[model samples]
Target: MKRLLEFLGFLAVLQGVMGLVHEFADWNVGVVGRIGFLDGYEVYASVALLALGGALFAVAESRRSA
Candidate 1:
């Protein structure tokens, strides 16, 4: 539960950062740059992922350890 959420959150954050770096630096990194449908919306998606990761962290923090 908590661990799973934390892990997912970490992944999301990593991808989000990667996406943003890819966009700004044109480093050819992250999945956002590889997706054809997300051509013009990479930044938005990256930001969304970052938000989702934060929310997931918040939820994980509010949970009790089993």
Candidate 2:
């Protein structure tokens, strides 16, 4: 469970960074740019993803390694 959370957190952080980079630099990277409904809200979504990733990491840290 700890490992799962850590992996998910890492993926979230990666995607968040990629989304931000894609939006700012127009690099055509990450899933944030491809979603149709998130046309104008990519930045906000990316930020949310970053927050979620942080939260996931925190939760993972608080858990016991079983």
Candidate 3:
């Protein structure tokens, strides 16, 4: 579970970064609309993803430290 959270957190961070870039440039390498089915809410969705990812990462860290 910890590993899964870590991986998901990492992926979400990466996707959020991509979404931010795509939001500005419209690059769209096929991941922009997929995250939370973001659609036109890319900016907000990306921010939310980043927040979720951060929380997940924190959980993973606690799990690891324990």
Q: Clashing residue pairs, candidate 1?
A: none
lDDT of 2 by residue, 1-66 (tens): 999999999999999999999999989999998999999999999999999999999999999999
Q: Model 2: which residue pairs collide?
A: none
Q: Per-residue alpha-carbon lDDT of model 3 for 1-66, expressed as tens digits?
A: 888999999998888787788888878743766666566798888787788889989999889533
What does candidate 1's lDDT look like per residue over 1-66, in tens digits? 999999999989899999999999989889877989999999999999899999999999999997
- TM-score to native of every candidate shown: 0.95, 0.97, 0.78
Give per-residue lDDT, candidate 2, residue 33.
Answer: 89
Where in model 2 is the C-alpha error above 4 Å? none
> What are the RMSD figures for all models against the true structure?
0.6, 0.5, 2.6
> 1 or 2, which is superior by lDDT?
2
**lDDT of model 3, residue 38:** 63
When 2 and 3 are scored with lDDT, the better candidate is 2
Rank order (by lDDT, best first): 2, 1, 3
> lDDT of each prediction vs. the true structure?
0.94, 0.96, 0.81
Order the candidates by TM-score, highest first — what do you get?
2, 1, 3
